[model samples]
Target: MGRIGKTAAAALLVLALSACTGGTPDPASSPGPTAAPPATGAAPAAATDPAGQVSGEAVSLETGTDVGNGRPASSHDGLMVRRRMVIAVHPTPDADLGALRRQLDRVAAERGVLLSDISPDVLDPVVLEHVVPEVIVALPPEGTHEEADALAGLAFGPVGSFTGVEHVHVGSVLVHDLQFRIGSADPAALAETIASEGILSDALGNYSTSLDGGALTVGYTGPLLSDELVEAVREGMARGAGVGPGEVELAPRSATGEGVDLSAEPEPAETEGAHASGRDDSGH
Candidate 1:
């Protein structure tokens, strides 16, 4: 090619490059979307197994660190055990949860809902007060109905012992608060599908439901309700909702009775060497 022709071609190329580069975004300015807020349920995708053991929910409950331990249990065993109930308490309009908690404690004390009954692991009695004020009470497995009666009385009876409580939700396998974009599918329908259409299986009638704003949370109360089973239901719900795996933003699965924290599962001790020194396991 001639020198003048080559220079003109190079100039054209530079102009084309400049046009293409005009819309190039700065990496620092354009960041990827952050992960969804952590799930409170905290269970494996495969934990939907029907264990026939209703132990209640295990909460990977994450709340603010400001509010202190609400009358924690005396022993460490309390922290390790399963949650008997996830009683979500709704307070009166503009009421302070901290103050409501204090009032609930006093009322519970008076009603004989012992501090030990409520799981100490879940900030004791009141699990979540910041966003959704909730309470936890136990109807002991071996303990008589009288004890259960006492808990029910403290929460519901005596005509408002714990004042300022506007609403209450009782569940075992708590689906954590969820996040839904403006265009996200409605999860509220999942409850109707699960309840009316037979999704609970053996754990049916053992679970409870709670609706906070746009989020619908289902928790199990029966000891047979396992975290594995909860995950199954969630997956089923997603399928029913006509959404893909990650499309429907269901919260993490946590149960009351017995739960195997899939995230915290221990590695097999007998893994030996992942790869023998300098030796590839894959056939070359």
Candidate 2:
């Protein structure tokens, strides 16, 4: 019996060893579960282009109304072209303020423009707001007719803000950088010839200048300026000479002649007074 018991014990011991050694797995040999699938659809990183701003569309002046002769103007999308001019006027030889006023009066009568001679100190901010001229010709500096035309181009911006004004037109004419590129014989032809030689580099940008007998025609590459403003400037130029619309020309910075010179006109009386008072023309 002792032998039988011993034998049975030995068998049981063998079975225990087999179960421990053969049935259990080797963890090192077993493959691990796959990592969670890579996170899906990660967003792309932001990038920037070297050149911003797509090419801007050209503004068309042909579609709007004419505001020539102060007939009223129109509005436009922000894309409207705005031109501005500033001129300086100097006192005529004697430093006479009254003569300045008289000159302005005469100019106003002939050009149908309003003129006001406010005291230099009295030209307060409020009055300035009310008296925002399309062209602010500073007296005591003087300017020329060409300068006036450039100012006329810039005046379009101010007039564009007026209600009932449609399209684009020049608001004021500055007499700065005013050069008389006047031609003889056929006024229009002369104007055209001069414009052909100098308009691109002198007048507005990319605008073409032409002549039709005595009439001067100006065209831009893109669209017309403010209907009112452009017409105003054209008519203002035409008042002395004939001005009209021409073809649209393309080519940047094509206009020449450096800018206008408003100082070409006579200066105001206050200018001399300011200069005499040791204030230089700047203070008055």
Q: Over all chains combined, what TM-score does candidate 1 have? A: 0.28
lDDT accuracy of residue 109 in candidate 2: 46
Query: Candidate 1, after superposition: displacement of residue 280 in Å?
Result: 57
Model 2 regions more than 4 Å off = 1-185, 189-203, 212-215, 242-284
Worst 10 residues of 1 by lDDT: 13-22
lDDT per residue for candidate 1 within 106-205, as digits (tens), equals 6456554543223212321122222233443443323332233233334333222335554333333211212221112354566676556666443223
Q: Which candidate leads in lDDT?
A: 1
- Local distance difference test scores for all models: 0.32, 0.26
Superposition error at 79 for model 2 (Å): 15
Per-residue accuracy of model 2 over 1-284 as CA lDDT, tens digit each: 12211222111100000000001122333211111112122221121112322222211111111111111122322212222222222222333445434543454444445443311211212112222222223222233323333222222212122222222111122111111222224666555444455433332333345565443445432212234444433443443343333322222232443332222322322212322322111211
